[model samples]
Target: MPTYPLLAPPPLSSGSPSAHPPSIVTSLVPPMFNAQAEESPKNLILKKVMNELDRINNGMNKSITLNSPTINDLEDCCVKSALNCFQSKVLYLSVPDGKLKKLQIIISNELHKIVNRVSDCKPKELEKAQCKPCDSYKEVDSQTFVQNLKTLLQKIYASQP
Candidate 1:
């Protein structure tokens, strides 16, 4: 009687099974590849806002380091630059009416505080011949402002359809 030949399994070296050769079926199939989807308009806007905030933060740090002689000078330089950067970015962004109103209020409040602090630190001349003690510079809490902006951005992004 004639017998048919049988295929043998791959040899195993020690007790562990040997690695199997690449299968033609798997090779023919496409690799587990996924294309990255494009970001939504809201996401893009949020990213731009975050980037602008970063730029403002960096500018503040640079101004602080360079104008360290007087606390007033440091505060003036840093605050002015930060406000300018923020204002420019705000103007550039075209937020929806609902979010725009909220953003405007928050930004206005923060700016008011900054402006008041700056005014308070300004040197005033006395009418009399006597010199007066200068008011100490009040540090602006930008971290809180930035955090609030980030929270607002998150809300805006979430609310987007």
Candidate 2:
């Protein structure tokens, strides 16, 4: 009988340092939102929006980890596509543009709308995913984090304005 060669497992974390030939994935800085910090109410609203968006985004990350295909699967697709970099496919949807600043505001606003629609998930649904149940009374820091991010993003936008 002939023995098959053993295969190495994919990196457990995204962008691990051990990835040979260091991936060419460039670091991206999300564009700033507004020109003046004190002049815009957009910061506050955007902050509120980002808070909600972060929750859903983070939940999606957790869901993928719990139920979706792993990086190994993506690697197979990359090989089939003849793509050299896995990072490239991960970011293909985010082709950066000079107008990213404006686009972000619109996106953030839309995200806020979506977040509003889905902020509360049924307890049973969360349980089905093996996630901790949400507490109606417990404090969530997402609001503050989102607010800070928005302020920072606003500053970035202001620079372009």
Candidate 3:
């Protein structure tokens, strides 16, 4: 059996100044949200959206034979396409452009519904040889073709200074 030491530190009183810890941590100031901040880190969310779009666009062109895609891939592409459609429609809206409050939250709920519907699945074998020529012909998967067209439309409508 080990013996306990008799000496113990006094309990801190709530009123004592020394009881408070020195705050040496510096808090970073968040970038101001305005027209200038539009191009700053404030637009990181927008960048995330663009990155997802790029990833989906790239995935659409992946070689069917090399990738050996399953039905899950097709379902994923469709789900992503639907989500992006909702995201793009709301994410770019200026405050003055829409009367809806918490547009992001609204879009989030819509995306959640899409995901929930496909939450459970069993993988099944898919025939890849039938689509092998698609990669060679630079064919886009119809599953993601609408998104591709939407992206091109966005590019066409883009404004510059």
TM-scores of all predicted structures: 0.32, 0.22, 0.23
RMSD (CA, Å), each prediction: 16.6, 25.9, 18.3
Candidate topping TM-score = 1
What tens digits encode model 1's per-residue C-alpha lDDT throughout 1-161? 33322333353355344454433465557897568677764466565665555555433322121101122233322433334334433333333455454554454445434333332223332222232122322323444445444554454456446
Which is the better candidate, 1 or 2, if ranked by TM-score? 1
Q: How are the candidates ranked when ordered by lDDT, highest leading?
A: 1, 3, 2
Instruction: At residue 41, give the lDDT of candidate 1.
Output: 49
- C-alpha-based local distance difference test score of model 2: 0.35
TM-score preference between candidates 1 and 3, better one: 1
lDDT of 1 at 66: 15
- Tens digit per residue, CA lDDT, model 3, 15-65: 475765554333445665576523433133333444444444343423221
Clashing pairs in 1: none
Which residue segments of model 1 deviate by more than 4 Å?
A: 1-22, 33-36, 61-143
Q: Which window of 10 residues has the lowest lDDT sum in candidate 2?
A: 80-89
